[model samples]
Target: MERSPSAQADLRGGVIWIALGAGIAVLSWRMDRLEHMHVNPYTVPGLVPGLLGAGLVVLGALLAWRTIHGGALARVAAPVGVDRIGDFRVVATGALCILYATLLIGHLPFWLATTIFVFVFTAAFDYKERRTAGTLARGLVVALIAAAATAAAVSLVFEDLFLVRLP
Candidate 1:
């Protein structure tokens, strides 16, 4: 039987997700293996990734099943021109945030770095627009809370609990 374009896209997306999940699982397994020498068996480095990978695998499997059995999917309207620019901007902003977190966190204090990261990243995404004030405010609040909680957690886990030092 012939399928609609949306169905074909769903099938393609499901296949892609499944492949990605498989890759993640493989990498997690490899990391787990390598971590054996450094990490105690009870504290496995791959534990989180392994679980996430497994979840992704299951989700991908479900998507694939829906695509195959649920009949033709609905067609989504493509956004006319200029939408690609926003997409690229989002991608670029994410990459920049990751780079800043990975490379600059060492040089700057956690709170200071995180605040700047949040503000700059938010502004980068055009959060200055009137409609975005609420979102930006929410984002800032969440970022602050998350950063504080993360710092406290790390301190408690490494300093008080595990006796490890933070970088």
Candidate 2:
């Protein structure tokens, strides 16, 4: 039976996720073990990433299975309307991610880069809605707080707690 376009897209996404996760697991597993330092097994560099990769694999498998054998595959629904605004948002988000990775990482400290990215991302997405409601300032304040909190948490957790150096 022919699957809907959304189901097909889900299947493709699931496959991609599985592939990406498998790659991450493999690479992470091959990372330095620090045998000389005799680090605890739980503290191995690959431990967390390997778990995350495994999680992705499991989730991807579920997505693919659902797409293949669940209601999405069984139904014969009409084509859904496409939202151009949603598409624009996706493109805009992707552009922001690209900018963060390419331009922000090396030039700025991790916390600062993260702060800017999160703030811009939040503000950019919420600007129109907040402006329409005449609450742009409040939205900006909220976004800034969220951005600062995220940056601080990430920096503290990774650098101070986990001892992982940030770029």
Candidate 3:
């Protein structure tokens, strides 16, 4: 029974997730409840987050267990090379999201910002698969359509259906 690199990585990641979830649950528990306002106990500020944290902890533990002793127990003759491009894309997407949330949201109109973000993100990722000029142009068109459609759907859902304000 040999452990693959993925399994070892998963075991490590699962432990981190378990710790993060527990910390979230603890913080949620320590949050103040608006007893003076006679807010319903079920409607406590931390209720949903607390439940989510507990769920994360449970799932993380299960992941760790499975990686160490379950399907990941299969033996492998050689380690595979890490996908640098894929990793870069993941980090880039995360950074793009953070920028969109922190810098773009209020600075630009919500629909416009969302459209631009989606367009750029889609084009950047899509370029990996099809790098030719024609394909790139087609990808941009596709990205534009996707961005417009997504923006419209989100605006309708939040503004009309949910009645929530967009930044």
RMSD of each: 10.8, 9.6, 7.2
lDDT per residue as tens, model 1, 1-167: 24235666677888888888888888877874445377566567777787788888889889889977876345454433435666788798888888777976788765466556655665555455523555766666665666666566665787778886555
What is candidate 3's lDDT per residue for 1-167, written digit by digit as tens? Answer: 24346776787888998999999999999988889999999999999899989999999999899887855556562456767776797899999999999999999999999999999999988896768554878898999999999999999999999999999
Model 1, C-alpha of 113: deviation from truth (Å): 26
- Using lDDT as the measure, the top candidate is 2
Q: How many backbone clashes does candidate 3 have?
A: 0
Q: Compose the digit string of candidate 2's lDDT tens values, residues 19-122.
A: 98898889889999888999887799998898898889889988998888866657675567677787799899999999999999889999899999999999
Better of 1 and 3 by lDDT: 3
Clashing pairs in model 2, backbone N/Cα/C closer than 3 A: none
Q: Per-residue error at 46 for model 3, in Å?
A: 18
Steric collisions counted per model: 0, 0, 0
Ranking by lDDT: 2, 3, 1
| Backbone clashes in model 1, listed as residue pairs | none
